[model samples]
Target: MSDQLLQLLFTGLTLGSIYSLIALALVTTFKVTGILNLAQGEFVAIGALLAISLYATGIPMFAAFILAIILVAIMGGCLERAAIHPARRASGLTLIIITLGLSISLRGLALLIWGTDTYSLPAFSQGGPLIIGGAVLNPQSFWILGLAVITLSVLYAFLGLTYAGKAVKAAVINRTAARLVGINPNTISFWAFVGSGALGAAAGIFIAPVTMSTYDMGFMLAIKGFVAAVIGGLNNIGGAVLGGLLLGVLESYSAGLISSGLKDGLAIIILLVVLMVKPHGILGLLGERKI
Candidate 1:
């Protein structure tokens, strides 16, 4: 491939990794709780801001990143318990509205804490771009890609191999049955929120170097990630990954060959088209599915 094409492809993959992580967070939470979390993006913003703050306070960057993830994960669990658990028996629409409110509140809180200023994080590695196969790749791109792979792999193992993971899956598939089988859906939902928060935080920290961090960035990322999740089939983890990568590539190509302004618009168009033609998503199953 030509250098320009290669560059676009690499950049697209890197961008896709971020989207995939966000989509994964959404899907995981939805699977367990049956509610789409509007505040998921705020978790990402919190992660980035907290990591920067901690790092600036004389903590090592890696330690700061880890601490931010843990803090965000705890916050997610607390939010679930304090705000969502009370309304767990409410209608799905009601729950969604609550999450939207939570999103707005979180944004305002972030603004109060960090103001409107945008901040940048230094890349995990300090270096220039690496040229391979005629493509100039950012050093941080590898970190993003590697972390994405590792995150997905760990998730797969958790869902496919562990007992707790199986219980969570069972709860998603049939809550009543899972309850009869001695699994507490509430516990599963709490853990799902924690896991999603951790994923969102990690994605934010990793992408901060490329995208920068700001209080308002969460909503955009959430929208894009939601598009990816819908395209891939919200209940299917693998589908979320595929959708994110596809969306990323589409956006990257549009920005490179067409116009940067059109990239987001194009993604929304694709999302609309997908919903019209294949409402269940690319990998979503036919017929009624629980998750």
Candidate 2:
């Protein structure tokens, strides 16, 4: 491939990694709670902003990052308890509307606290681009890719290996059955939110250095993430990953070959095509409902 193509591929992969994280968050929450959380991106924004704020207050960068993730995870649990738990018996549509309201509220709160200004963070490592095959790649890009791999590996293990993970899977499959076996669906759902929040926050922290962060950035990220989820088959975690990376590459190429404004439109078009042609996504089984 040419240098330009290589550059686009690298950039696209980085963006895809971020989208994958967000998509994972969405999928996890949906599997356990059956609610599409529109406020998921706010967790991203808050994570970045919180880390910056904490770091400015003399906390170490790594500490700030961890604390931000922990704080967002706690907020996720609190949101479930305060807003979602009471309405557990409500319709999915109602829950979605509630989440939409929560999204707006979170954005407004972020605006009040962080204002309209965009903020940047230093990359995890100090370095220039790495040249490979005549293409320049940012050091931070490697960090993103590495973290993505680690996060996905950990998540796969968590969901496939551990007892808690098995319990979560059981709950997603049949809440009543899980409860009959002494599992608390509510607890599983709550922890799913927490995990989703941590994933969002981690995505934010990783991407902020590359994309910058603003109070209003959450909705767009949420939209893109949601698109990724839809394209990947909303219930399939592996499909989400594929969808995100594929979307990112398509978006990158669209921007390079056409206009930046058309990139998003291209994604939507692809989504429509996917839905019409293959609604189950690439890795998703046609009849599989549970994670």
Model 1, position 223, has a per-residue lDDT of 84
Give per-residue CA lDDT, model 2, range 229-270, as digits (tens): 988888777767877898888899889877899987887787
lDDT of 1 at 185: 82
Worst 10 residues of 1 by lDDT: 282-291
| Deviation from truth (RMSD, Å), model 2 | 2.0
Per-candidate TM-scores read: 0.95, 0.93
Best by lDDT: 1
- CA lDDT, candidate 1, residue 92: 98
- lDDT tens readout by residue for model 1, 1-291: 489888998889889989999998998788778999999999999999999999999999999999999999999999999888999999999999999999999999999999999999988898899999888999999999999999888887887799998888787676688889899888998998898889999989999988889998888888889999998878777778888998998899889988999987887898898899887897755444443
